[model samples]
Target: MSHTANKDALAQGTHHLIIDGIEQYYHVMGEGPVCIVHSGGPGVRWDYLRMPLIEAFLKLIYLEPIGTGASGRLADPRGYTLARYTRHVDALIDHLAVGTVYFLGHSHGGFVGLRYALDHLQRLSGLILYDTSPTTGPEFGQSIEEALQRFAARHSIRPEVPKLLAAVRRVFAAEAQAAATDEDATRELQQIFPVYFADYWGREREFAPLRESVWAWSDPLRGQEPEPYDVRGELGRIAARTLVLAGQEDAICVPSWAQVLHAGLPVSQLVVLPHSGHFGHLEEPHAFASAVRNFVS
Candidate 1:
């Protein structure tokens, strides 16, 4: 289906939370048990994945972490520690008065979700990991450094809004086109790219106020430093039921990471979606949403 069609498939709503003196943004839709969706990067906004699945979910909550998107940027980089982030989740839950919730994290968000489970397992009904890793392996650490360097270089250029939007459109279109050949694939690529691109640009605009802190938080990682986390030792401590999903073609967070995550979580199931990449939710929305509904139910 086209991106528009996919979006049309979703029922959405908006809400906000104030935690640690920052206005944390979130979108809420559906009703039942609450399910909070966390973004992959500490910097990525939550809009990319907030959609009709909310209709199927009891409730879907999308949060933009502090120092990114609509949340206030902290002058102190030390304030960006992982523990502080987990606390942000805590604050949001408390602010919303949500007694219990299902935690869904993509990429880095997955790590954060697991960390939350470690500390607040009683608050979670289950855990959903999308294209995420339990820990950053040696090879993954090197890759993260490379990616940070690339982001640093891009930050230096500081491309204008138009240029950034155009670039996003071109890159996603090229990738989607390269990945699928069927007419349905082409139509979906054309439709979804713009919607995703628009959401990305919306985040870019919302992110303008916090560019400095965002860049600062990302700068050190460009150099040789151990990755920010080592959660492998603590995975088994996660007491919540977990479902792990990996894209068949995700080069960044490879499928093996999902396998590793599954092995660590005693109550976890793994699913690998064929012909999909890092953004499996977008690549296979129906399947993605179905898997989530099944597990969440």
Candidate 2:
């Protein structure tokens, strides 16, 4: 099919493309410059990353990364890696026939976006590193442990705090993840959903529906985990303008990480949402949308 025809089909609704002998799924919304969004979890459904406000100014293509949602799962679950994810993004951009589009990656998706920007710089007009870091493993793990302690301390009096902490712990437990069904993962995600927001309990009326609806899938890693990621030295190489976004109270991807990204990237800006945690897009939609629009425009 022609490039124009391909773009038209993408904007209409859900679409799939055969990439690397597997089905790759994506959805499109809005009507301007193409901005491909990659969601977090490495296994979370893409629905959570939908940016209606940003969509108002830029055509948003939400990618269902390989091994997530209805996208094809790997023959060897260990086969899911940043390299493979980057390749898929490259393929999707090529398939779209939209030259030099914007790229936004959240959480684990941000990891993929970083690698993609480094490896495929020419294809991106801009990069949005939303609630992500340049490295993971020991440093990232330590940060999470510390953040959780703070989160626990902050809500110590709340009866549900202990339960939420336990659920978060189980969610990260290797065995639990390996054995988790969609229902199990989704339940755990819902249980610990409050930690992802700065004030989930305070704003329960507004956020309850999303908290109840969010879902996740465990990464199918049968002892083949990706190598510890660190790209601080390589940040200088990426010339594409970047927007490093973080939430003030984000327990996982902390603000320090965003600071590192902002400091390292040669041409980049950082925006910290005061009233948000990990999910700033949902926590502060208008602010998130404005930052994105101004940067892209």
Candidate 3:
């Protein structure tokens, strides 16, 4: 299927950037305070966050990370790291001629946004982290299990734990073992949405139709990570005021990571939205938008 474009998006138009003979894409909307919103996936596009109320809170500048959406792919491919993504945003800010801006990076986008803020604190007014963790490791351990256990409080673990866990692990191993490890494998991970949402079983169908617009071939980056893969050490360097948003039920970027981020940053606030999953912006739009508006105000 062709990627869906929001042609009727209120007051919005597609934009582009060309560097190193590679063209990149980003969408701009609204006329409020400037806020750049980066979507999840080191490989996925920003198609999922185009809600109406988001525009009401702030001017939304949706950046299409290189190799995804309508953007050009890097020739080296190794340049697909979070640091490269940070540079993409850097160029956008200069190209657009913006003074100070607010950045809202969701999931992997949050990883990029965090890196960008730490390096260019002077140009940022605030940082908004949603459904993202500072680093990767045990901190992101089987979030599906964590999400389930959250629902069954007094219990140490969910009764269906063994089978559910084995199944999730099998999928991960299968993807890793595949003959080809590409962004399309990241696309296949979408089929396992049950592990991503608060109530995947109940809302499985509602989640199916919504698919990734573009799946860039960048999983090679997911595999070449440092041992601990933890960025807690650098969180203190994020001088920009920060807002950490977590879905109390999000298994992907669990709320515990949010707490860690809150504790690390010199100045930050944590808000765990109730009954939300990784996609809290979509699951609870009004509340998410309000939190963003208040924080940036």
Candidate 4:
């Protein structure tokens, strides 16, 4: 669809539902077959995926689970367990009166979506997994720790928040100054680029909200112990048509996990995008949207 057409098609709505005494926030847009898009982090804001996927699906439902985004934070970390997350999704579906929906999940959201398929098979029309795994092993956890350590080391050289904010301001200021010199560059750099970058950077800033909310719900579980969440056994029981999409460059979830998920689902198809990473939808929007549209259709 054209940009204007898509913009005109968008409709926004919100609903508050309580699950286990914790209020969760959910947003609905467009109108058609229901498709619920889950965020990557157990705590990531749903807004991160809103523009790309919501525009494509049009009739999409973006859910911010309890203790995430606009949702109320939970005091107990025990309530943030996988089982409880699954129950929250069920409650949202019940509240929406949606008998069945196409469940689209990314990263951590993919794990929650997998659990939903296992526990409530009858409620799903189809399943779309983007860079997610059914179960995470010890090696996976170790790899993540290593990556985070590397990231910390890289950012440690900088002066922290002020430095980062200064950099953003400098770039935007440069663009604005350039726009003052030439009308074309003004429109391209100042008007276009700044708006895009601001929106993108704003989403990154929202990660703090995500982390804090999840911490609120999961703090009590910290330093306690790690428990196994095995969804491998239940994979074969999933009856919904499944679409597994993976990015070739995704280091975290890895492409192999998508292959494993495809192998496990009784009726499923797998598509691996080239030159793409964990955020395949953002990295390759046309291909990602086309793959999902074709599979779900």
List model 1 lDDT by residue over 1-297, tens digit each: 111212321236655656667777767677667777888644544665655754565677777777656667666544565676788888777766656778889887887898899999988989999888876656665543443334334344444534544443453332322222223333333332322211233345543333322221231112222345778888888878999998765645777788989999889988888756567776667888788878876
Q: Residue 80 in model 1: shift from native, Å?
A: 1.6
Predicted model with the maximum lDDT = 2
Candidate order (TM-score): 2, 3, 4, 1
Would you list the rank order by lDDT, best first?
A: 2, 3, 4, 1
Candidate 1 stretches greater than 4 Å from native: 1-12, 142-227
Q: List the residue pairs that clash in candidate 3.
A: none
lDDT of 2 by residue, 222-256 (tens): 32535668998899998999999999899979899
Clashes of 2: 0
lDDT of 1 at 37: 82
> What are the lDDT scores of the predictions, listed in order?
0.63, 0.85, 0.72, 0.64
Candidate 3 regions with alpha-carbon error over 4 angstroms = 1-11, 142-167, 170-187, 211-228
Which candidate number has the best TM-score?
2
- Stretches of candidate 2 off by over 4 Å are 1-5, 173-177, 219-226
Taking all chains together, each candidate's TM-score versus the true structure is: 0.68, 0.93, 0.82, 0.69
